[model samples]
Target: MTSNTILQNATETTISGDAQVINAGRDVNMVHGPPAGLSQLLRPVSNATYTRSGPVAKCDPGTRVEVINMIRNWLNRRDKQSVCWLNGPAGYGKSALSQTIAERYANKGRLLGSFFFLRGAGDRSHIARLIPTLAHQISISVPVTKRLIGRALEEDCTMLDSSASIVHQFQRLIANPLSSPLNLFSFFAKSKILVIDGLDECDDKVQMAEFIEMLIDMSQRDQLPCRIFLTSRVEEHIRKKFGDARAQSVLYCIDLAAFDARPDIQLYFEQEFGHIYDQNLPIMRRIPQPWPSSQALSVLLDKAGSSFMFAATLVRLVGEDSMPSKVLQEVLDSGSNGLDPLYKQVLSSASPTPAFHRVIGTIMILLTNQSIESLSLLLDIQAGEIVFELLKVQSIVKIPGDDNKPIMLYHTSLRDFLTTKS
Candidate 1:
């Protein structure tokens, strides 16, 4: 099927509030409930039905069509590589595209699993949870594997434990189950895929390297049943690992920076601005038909510099503020270039102080994620005060309703901005 057709179906499903798509050829529907013991350990992304906290970002339809079609074609091809690595710099929309692909395959009962590595999101940001999470999702989606995974867990209770080697987890919880006779016979999909987004975001560098090596090993040996789709910023270690001679045969790589994204950015800005204009029609009635003039859009597009995050952040800022025109002007007027000026604008609006710096700084440099309550105790500040400070920068910072949930930046660029030496 064409990418546009797939997107149209997905859009219809989303609009109906029913995430399920008609299982065209599958014997059984993808399981909803998590597999037994491993259920608690899985850290799946927030998509369609699976419930992980925090907001999920998806590619805006009509945008990213070329990349989407390329990935879809890769997934559907018969004699394709087992692993596809889509890498780009931050804010280039890697995660958004991953989310889009996952949702598309998931609706078709072909997605085995997906894990989006979110920094400051507890287990979601760690590699230790990755294999187990994929195992759990696989079991639930492929029923035959559920029993096999359970049996494996029963035999080696430590298979899912953090102390266990990643190789052990992959072998026992994932490879063994899916490759088993019963599973291979029962789970008869042409393509079963696992989407891993933001691998660079995972906190454990050692584990991340080990996991990539393990994937290469498995792919080389043809031991895994599902194709692996991964998206991440182009970190040195990851690039080096994937660049290994051994990986060349089975690994397909795409760099987002190579694409001319100006057209896509234009489409996104047009649609988003149109939405904003429609929503605030009464207030915006006086504005011209093309509310944001072509000249204004060209300026914003040039500033975007192949970064979707910049475009998206600009849209969020303008849409949320009462004075949309003013927000757009301020963003254009910022003297500095790239995401820094925008980041600075957002940070400055929060009215930074020693206390604010202490709060946000602690979040940025945290070795691991912490909840507001825990952060309060660690910093010796009241939880309410932390919330008050975060409120000013709600556009960039995400403050969860529950104090126990981790506070997170909408994008990692905020931390980069804060840490970069002036």
Candidate 2:
């Protein structure tokens, strides 16, 4: 047996293109086919590009060049470290960077799977779906693993049950299947990658820790077939888990807060504002050639203060409003400091009501995603009334035009702000 794979059954399946190997079982008619079987048991982020939604925001063109290159180099390297951690404070653009990396690698066929955790997004916000989701994606990416995983599930039957342990779920759904000699030989030839973003958003701290421990254990044993890229805020539970010397050996950590993003933020503002100016050209004509005066840009940039969330929120406010210039002026005149002050200003501008408070508060704390209809029924408020209140805070809340889609915060910081002691 080679270090990468067991060669005993290497002759069973021949190497072939995706139609034959990577995308196996799609054409098969069986209701209990491996692909169909796995799909039934997993819940993935439906909005990912691979699914129904469009591509997510990547690094803006010509931005984050250094960090992007660093990760690319790490991926290209032949080394023992199988895990990379990109940790930073909120608003440092960790998710953007992770999305960029995932898309880039997935295009090249080196991506095994990616999971992006989003708070209040139902299964995406918790640990229960993590392994099953990854296993499903893995089965698609490596068809041999799909058959093996299906077999494991059929044999155990309870691997995905709510009462099953994370360890049991991992072993049955991921570890045992990939441990097969056939998988080790073919799929383990080169390094594949798994990208997981927003680990802190997962509501269960104990499960999150256990998941990381499993990764560390696999990395230490040279068992992971692909490298894992993870991103999250430096929360205490997460920080302490990665702080250990043993964990550090198999995992390389990057603190994004340590890097200055002024250059990138400035570039983003220039490009986004340029688009805004072009779209509102008739109205923009009244303003100067550069649109926002350099002084105004300077003031807004200062307020941004290493926070992309602030910059992004302000851009949406200006671009979406009837009078972009007027909104810009209001943002400039606002006296609040940091995100809290800006949040307060936004809330104040909305003329928040008791109903609005109930709605927004419920959004911040909901364990799962909810639509306006569900919320109205749960809170005993009229759906139209809820919609009217949400319209006022459109800058921060994402209310889908489709009533079926869940309303979500534009940034997790909004929830953090609303929940924190004043």
Candidate 3:
């Protein structure tokens, strides 16, 4: 027999002659499935777009431009290594700004990976889940590690398995992949950027701290060509862990509150309201008014307090009704005390049961400014169910558009009201 026939026969024999019988006279292509464990490794990662519209009033343009330039410079610069830690108070636009940067890099196919830590979201707080999530994004496949992960999954295990430390798993399975010569990092002397947001939201603060320490160590040791961009509210533990002067020097720390991007926020609102008005009021033939005239926008900006979430939420709430003028009037009239009342009004309008007040109360008490999943799980309810109820009062709670993370109160003012009332 010729080598080709012999090879075909051997292939048929491997399948116990089943293939030979099935394809009696037809040419059969011998196919090898992807490497063992590759099935799990090849699952598509998310690169969802997170959109926000308004004049970008919440962040200062000059500051944002400076930050963007810094990041771009870091990416392009050779012989200089850098990390960036973006810190801010809760409700500030740190995550949004990080997302914006990630989106920009993605457009150029230069983004390595990005992970958003949603506290209370199942398993997300653990390094095991975080590493795999990021590796999937970079299309780095580790078959052996995947098998281990699969085995853990089959046993119905939590990421914090007694068998292995999450940090070790991350070092071996995830971080090591980027160090390989065949990987993308070989072509670029500078590492690809990895964005991790909401560090304060991670449930296990100690473990998160350890992860950060390990990352710093790895970066210093040059184990991998990777730089990290992290965003979070300034939690005491995190601040202490990363606040060392030496670490700070190696890492660029930007306070999101320093940015004055009110124009962006206003433009965002105008676009959102403009779209809604055009779609719903086409028959009325009303020419879209220039939104939030300079003075009116300034008033909204004063209320925004450098929080993108707050600005976005207010725009959504005010834009819901056709009477923008009346909405603006009521908001302005409420002054500083009016924000909470607006939230309460929105909540009271949507909730059907008197029990909802208790529910709202419970949510406020449980708020970690992290994932809504934990809250839902704690209440023994489905996330979708809670979200459906919350949507009715969208003016008060803002659900992120991309993922099923917990709903966030539109502003610090809303959270303050809920906490104070409780």
lDDT string for model 2 (1-422, tens) is 11122234346654333222222133321122233446775655555323335224568888888889889887887776888999988878888898888888888988877888888777778888888888888888878888788788767767777777887787677766666776864456336788889999999898898888888888888776678899999888888788878897788888887787888888899899999999998888888868577888888888888787788888887888878888888888976546777777678888889999899889888777789989989999998899999999888888877667788787888988988787
Cα deviation of 83, candidate 3, in Å? 1.7
CA error at residue 339 for candidate 1, angstroms: 1.1
Candidate 2 CA-lDDT value: 0.78
> Mind giving the per-residue lDDT tens digits that candidate 1 earns over 254-343?
889999999999999999999999998877888887968998788888999899988888888788777787788888777655777887
Clash pairs detected, candidate 2? none
| Cα-based TM-score, every candidate | 0.84, 0.86, 0.70
**Stretches of candidate 3 exceeding 4 Å from the true structure:** 1-36, 39-63, 140-163, 182-191, 276-291, 337-345, 348-352, 358-391, 398-422
- After superposition on all CA atoms, what RMSD does each candidate show versus the true structure? 13.2, 8.8, 9.3
Query: Would you give me the overall lDDT of model 3?
Result: 0.59
Please report, in order, the local distance difference test score of every candidate based on alpha carbons.
Answer: 0.79, 0.78, 0.59
lDDT of 1: 0.79
